[model samples]
Target chain A: MAVDGTRPYGAYPPGSETEQVGIMTSTVTILYFAALREQIGRESQVATLPAGGMTVTALLAQLGQQDPRVAGAFAAEPRLRVAINQTLGGLEQIVRPGDEVAVFPPMTGG
Target chain B: MSVPGAGVPKVGSPEMGSPELDSLGAGIHVAVQEAPFDTASEIARLSALSDRTGGVGLFFGQVRGGNGLVSLTLEHYPGMTEKILHALAHEAVQRFGLLGCTLIHRVGTLRVGEAIVFVGASAAHRGAALDATAFLIDRLKTGAPFWKKEEFADGHASWVAAREEDEHAARAWSQDTPPPA
Candidate 1:
């Protein structure tokens, strides 16, 4: 059961941050959707950020280095958008630890 | 104007303890569900939400069968989608001084020609209602978080890219959408 009644779209796995980041507190739950999700082959992941925080652009650059699929997807679709904690934001927005970051292609819904 | 589902209904009272509305009247209803919404019922409900409503405007979008499309799959960010949709609907209601409004967007896989999204707004005059309706849908296309993937008859499926024209439409409305006259 999801924390909410709705099905779990994506949630952090149990202690996923600890497992990935070891002792880093600068970790965030990252989510992908649509074309980006399909390209990345994973719906969500917990990633460790630098000590303080990083901009949405910096986070993508780091993630792309860790996984080239991220690079290719963003390269193929240059219009990828990002949101911090479910709020749509620009690439320059700073993403802090424990924030939920979502990266996806342009919205086609109405 | 007597019984519901009988004769021409009036924009009158909601049923006792109706979840859809209350004595104060529900100003907005936003649904991001899988099942298709009844466009006619939604329009009627919008008008019935208030007695001062003189006109109602509706916009419905159905999937197109062109380009050998078989079905379209809609994916949305669950927690984020509802939040953004309600915010959009609330803005539409307040901005247009609408009496009430209903906005529904369907998810899951849908066949061609199926209703994908619908928005209806009621107001004192047609202008407010129509402009609100247009504003709601246009903003939703660019603002909402739903994504669509089209499945072709040849077993090839592709995600629908956001259209530039949609951005222009939303921007146009933001510039100077007049109030009710």
Candidate 2:
């Protein structure tokens, strides 16, 4: 079965799947800045995440493979931090569709 | 304008006596300016702002002619920029018993010799005030998310490289032990 990206992670919302059949999938927003932004070209972009299960690290790996610059950026591992909707989260955290994930260098700001 | 803590009236206050000099007195004021700063006004504001505090510390960071670079532009992450600045100010106040402090950082296009940042601090003694001023500026330069794009005289523009030295300066502040009484 082709997994629909629009469906939220885990169990689908009650009855909504049946109510709206064949709806095009939606995409999530990813924000990049500084070196990351320069490499990505665009400051922010919308992407569709694979269904079933995907950890933050896994998602990052996929992004890296898609863009060589992104791959080089995350090669430093812990040097880069990830935030979901502005709050810091670990790599294992599950990301849902429509979530805004921001990737940037370790914060040096006061 | 009137002095910060003084009973005098504010600079622009209608009740003030002279148009040139307001109740706040004639000297120290802090402003994030688009045009080049007036050194005379800055000196006046600094002098007027001082009172019981025996020491006044100030830092003026200007955009350097980056190897013959004529123009520079600063970019910052909107909401996050202001949030970080406010947090830094609060931290400075808590760490040092500062009488008063002012920080003004300009964002956007700027030319060489134009002031990019201003940090002012006042305390009971000079030592504390000077240290606090240094600490604030050091932290702001390294920790802040602002990025600078330098346009050289050759018409080429590039993002300024992040300096490890700045990080070291900020790290020193974290390691410092409180001074002895």
Candidate 3:
């Protein structure tokens, strides 16, 4: 809920993640896995969150705004799993600065 | 370096990397790698790790053929995979009164009939070791961060979905009682 209402949800405005650079308050490295990774076309990317941190749900919601492909990926799958750092996390988990967040589909390996 | 989509699923961070230790302790041996492991060597290692090992149980899983499946790819979060697998192995040792335990999962492309996973447990009695062996794999199927994607000979591939049965099995272990010390 800490996301700024004035600006839009997507981290970069065409490239806000890198354009704003040093001005952003919180930066998180987001990781993609499994089907999501295949769809996103990248393994990992950095994103920014407004001050005071935001819930994992909010972060994903923001990332969903990145572009049509990202948006489509989030919209396509409803059961996206999340983890803060390496431990599994709930939707309400508060993602803070410098956190390594992972988003992936449900596990199926034996 | 991990080449994500290059068909080679790497284990651990590029810098941190998977630890090559044979066994961290007398009670736990966990590894996430791409190479096919020697099951006999692993069982012998676990047996020799503890002096009281009287019962050693093992379960080895391989990629199944048929259904037009050509190969299967396993994906996992490097650092997290290692951490969780080790924790589960340690827990089984305690919960089953096991003298030692082993859990290994292979990542990357595995053709049909190729080995994919190995779970083993050793204890003072047959019952504890047997139950622990089951517990280790059941819990791992649900708790571990690994994911499986199946590729068909028809040129199609899809990630496997999680199964409810695995979740139930992992939970059943929680309710079961451990053997007496």
Best by TM-score: 1
Residues A1-110, model 2: lDDT tens digits? 12233422112222233223314244455666556666656565555677654688888887787777668767743467676644557889987765666677654321
lDDT of 2 at A80: 70
User: What ranges in model 2 sit over 4 Å off?
Assistant: A1-28, A47-56, A72-101, A105-110, B1-51, B176-181
Cα deviation in Å at residue A48, candidate 2? 5.4
Please report the TM-score between candidate 3 and the true structure: 0.81
Q: What is the per-residue lDDT of model 3 for residues A1-110, given as tens digits with 9 covering 90 to 100?
A: 22222322111122233234334447877777788877876666778777788999899888887656667887877888898877899999999877778898877778
- Interface DockQ per candidate: 0.31, 0.09, 0.31
Fnat of candidate 3, please?
A: 0.55
Candidate 3, residues B64-149, lDDT tens digits: the string is 99999999988887667776776677677656777788888898899999999999888888988888888888888878778888
C-alpha positional error of residue A61 in candidate 2 after TM-score superposition, expressed in Å: 2.1
Poorest lDDT segment (10 consecutive residues) of candidate 3 chain B: B1-10
Ordering by lDDT = 1, 3, 2
lDDT of 2 by residue, B1-181 (tens): 1011122234356754555434222332333334555545554554456476676688888877747889777754443444455556656755776666666777668888777887877677888778888888888886655667788887888766667887777778886564332
Quote model 1's TM-score: 0.82
lDDT of 1 at B142: 85
lDDT of 1 by residue, B73-115 (tens): 9888765776677667767776888888877888889999999
